[model samples]
Target: MPAIAMETYQDHFDRPLQERSSLEPAWLLEHRKQAMTRFTTLGIPTTRNEEWRFTPIGPIAEAPFAPAVSVAQSVDQTVVSHVGFADMECIRLTFVDGRFVEDLSCLRPLHAGVITGSLGQALAAHPELLEQHLLASDWWHAHPFANLSAAMSVDGAFVYVPDGVTMDVPIVLLNVATAPGARVANYPRSLLVLGRSAAASVVECYVGTSYGADLTCALTDIHLGPNAQMDHYLVQRQSPTSFHVGALGASISRDGVFSSLSVQIGAAIARNDIYAHMGGENVECTLNGFYLVDGNRLIDSHTMLDHAYPHCNSHQVYKGILSEHGRGVFNGKIMVRQDAQKTDAKQTNQVLLLSDDAKINTKPQLEIFADDVKCTHGATVGQLDSDALFYLRARGIPLEDAESLLVHAFAADVTDRIRIPIVRQQIDETLLARLPSPQH
Candidate 1:
């Protein structure tokens, strides 16, 4: 069969700024104009681009129609109840169809200097913070989808932790796309301003209940103050027929620590981009991700860790499991600037393919401009160990059970890094459910 033409995929690019121009601020209006121009000139990404050469987006280009507007949906309490974290208490914020639902949320009274609310409400209540960190557009212009999201996103969450306050409970953001054919896109922009010595943890869940063609574009921005420590987790389990795109950027100050964990299991086509900058001395950042792809699904994860100051350390490890005709992509880059002496950065990407048709493309890169830095990267793509399978079978385990056990062990390596027990357990169950059954 012949391949589909890119131009026919109008739904991906037909969303012009004028369609929703009236909903944004004057500055945002002007910015959207510029962004639209850039998007029009550049158009959709092609395989010719070095960054996208391995992963073809023709399937996405040929997808039909625009995302659905406002559709009615109800959360299946049974399904929602199945997803829970029991290790620690949290302020649960829920959103259905990309719109905040207060009745479904649970917020506990917090200590001083912590503000959590819908982005729209926060804009009205705390305009100054919004003006400072809402959309720092100058930092990046390579991804046109990011610009498109900034222009069209309607509802999301906003969290701000004031100086000198420690939040013991994790602030959880649950975004659920319930309606089938719902074109719900949200830009959940969070600005974490931790005063010196403050600490907090956050969890973000992206889920879908119905199986329809949906589109989700989410953006999260985090800022860590000096001596602050934060752990951020992003869990995605949308419909298998949906399109998901996300971008996250973090700025770390002196003596700060930032830990990130990303889990991907749903969506027909999903892409996640993360960028972290160590702006202060003695800062440490850890980036970890795990993804599972089955059937014809595709999941892509890209990251960039920038070391700009002295005595900064970073570690990145991403692992994936592919089955059937599933495909996975992982691209990681580490940059050490000239002033970033005494920097230690390491990155690794590994993939395990279960079928002959399954495929994975992985790349790990290190760019060092400092002579006194220690930076290294490695990537590997392979199948499960036949020797290990034989050993399991020799121990009287069934072949299918052995395969499942090995696959789960490989994935558990990453899940164990998750400090939140509730989040870890939820991910474990979701992954097991998505994996191929032992009988298969």
Candidate 2:
């Protein structure tokens, strides 16, 4: 494939980083320039790239790119109301068109040394931590989107939890795009560092107005110190005409526990890249994801799990449901390093298609350089069971209702793994509403 012309998209790419230079560090500026150079050399990924073989970026690259501009329009409360998660009381940080809205947010006072605020505020208040953790990690290789996010991100959230502080209440980061016919782009960056023995749960939600052609490029970096525990969930529900791309990098220390759940149900094109590194012994990690697509929508998930230390365990399971002309992609890779003895890793990917036009491509890969490791990977793609459908019909259940029940049942297997009640309920309701009627 030919390289995409940089002249066509240079205007959209240059404006955001230029306007935010006053706030960004000088070192970061140099890094961004280097990243932009790499982006220019690599251009947009195509079907030929091994990592992106099943997904295509031609449509996104062809679309005229535009930077999100400031607007005075208030966020639609109806859209906000649609974002609640059962009984969970949260500190809601709201962003409209890549800028923070202080008045619209509901932030709870912290009891200790933890700091949770806008990225701009953090840059001024906690420059030391930001200097150490902000885009300084080594996980930013070969990922064009991550590089773009670091170079052009204007606004995002920053979270810091001090040592021994446990936050029981989930912190909610809500990002919404309010303009119609505007090609909006956002880089919602989050830096979460859990000190030794600290614990917390976080929920990140990406939503947009009902009628907008938007784009969101988000990045989250989580660092877990020794004996720390953290649970994270990302729920993406953007406009059907929007595009969403995200990347998550997590590092776990000795005796740390990290769990992540991702649910994607919106956007015309969506892609997610998740990377987990077990850097210490006795660490454990779990990665789970579910995606539902309809119409001409496309969703892709690419994940990597690295066991760099000994006596660690990791598990990953991803499921997808496609209907109409929808398409889905899943790629999971697990690597056990040479010195990482006694490592246990498991991975699985499953898909269910409801129409002949629907398509799914799934790949699960495992690479082990350790002599004493247990690893497994499996992938499956198929449709609903005809015998089960006939059995339900024979039992006098309406076809549509039976189909809904079965679809729900299939998705429930993954949703049940969610540890948070409020988040679990929200996933259930969202899946129930977005799923197609079983009447077909």
Candidate 3:
């Protein structure tokens, strides 16, 4: 089908305007309408499309629309405390389903002129600022999910750091999807803008409380000005029976540095897409990711790095450990334009299979048009080294423990890049907790 009839959502969209937040701007209504129009034009993706050839998204496209569609907002702090990450000194914004929970959020004193709060709130206070950065590319759409997310997003995190300011405290946006008895679909959104000479660290986490088959669709947009630097991380930890699809896009300017890592270890089916546009000179970008899947689960990742300027550098490394019929996919593409001379880029993808049924499909591609640019790509798929396993067994180590140790060490290549100590430890423990049973 070329389009999903508007009749599917017209009634819901025509509801009483008074039901929405009073602070909501009039422009937002039009913004959502445009997004819906684009979504209908794009329709749902299918396996025929090269981008989603291996994904086989029939489960998503054929599933009936989930009801009670309102974002769940009644989750109390007690439940959130148990969902995992230990309490630490930082700025945090909590969301249940897609609803923002103000009481659960804690804020610290930020530098002068720095603004960090709810996106719904920012729309009223700084509409001009949001309009400048939020989806500024007119006459453009990055597939249907991006449009669907824009159409359905209600409240999410918003951050803006002015020039010459530095934020020391890490910023965390915790999203928890809760559905006890029914299946629900939610879309979460975030926008971050950093000015020249600004630096900060941020985290986007998606967690589910129940084992129900919930669906989460998320999108994040980031922009960095000249000389700006930022460290970003995306972590997903939902029930193994749920589904997740998320996308992130970033733009960096001259002398800017953008570092991001993805740690995905949840859901039965998950697809992550990342795109980076380096259009300024002397820019540095790093993309690192780690995924652990087991028990019939699947994880897929697709990344695109485009270098449109000279004197830029990009590095990427992704590793996955799969077991128990679990499957994984990694497709990374790097492009260097003709004008992008003096560019240096490297990409690698590695997978460790713990069982005969576990499998991975990896593709690392490099498209270079610049004669002076240096770009390389590689991918490897292998099981645990018998030499290493035998060495551990020779020391009287239990077979299962030896296997677990090797798996943990295999993950260090990507996990070691995490700068936050607490988050590092959290991922480390979670990795061990989810280790698969030995196939004796």
- The lDDT for every candidate, in the order shown, is 0.77, 0.82, 0.83
User: Tens digits of per-residue lDDT for model 1 on 1-440?
Assistant: 02242233234434544554565566655755565556455566767888777767665555433433444346644545656742247887776766676766777897876888787677668777776766553544577566655544556788878777788788888877764543444444444556677788889888877776677777677888899999999898888987787888888889999999999998999989989989899999999999999999999999999999999999998999999999999999999999999999999998988888888888888888999988889988887788999999999999888998999998999998999887888888878877763223
lDDT string for model 3 (269-340, tens) is: 999998888969999999999998898888999999989999999999999989888989999999999999
* Per-residue error (Å), model 3, residue 260: 0.6
- Runs of candidate 3 with Cα error greater than 4 angstroms are 1-26, 67-73, 137-140, 437-440
Off by over 4 Å in 2: 1-5, 8-21, 85-88, 390-394, 437-440
Model 2: colliding residue pairs: none
Candidate 2 structure quality by residue, lDDT tens digits, 267-373: 99999999999989999999999999899999999999999999999999899999999999999999999999999999999898888899998889988899998
Q: Cα deviation of 398 in candidate 3 (Å)?
A: 3.1
Query: lDDT, candidate 1, residue 335?
Result: 91
Q: How many backbone clashes does candidate 3 have?
A: 0
How many clashing pairs does model 1 include? 1
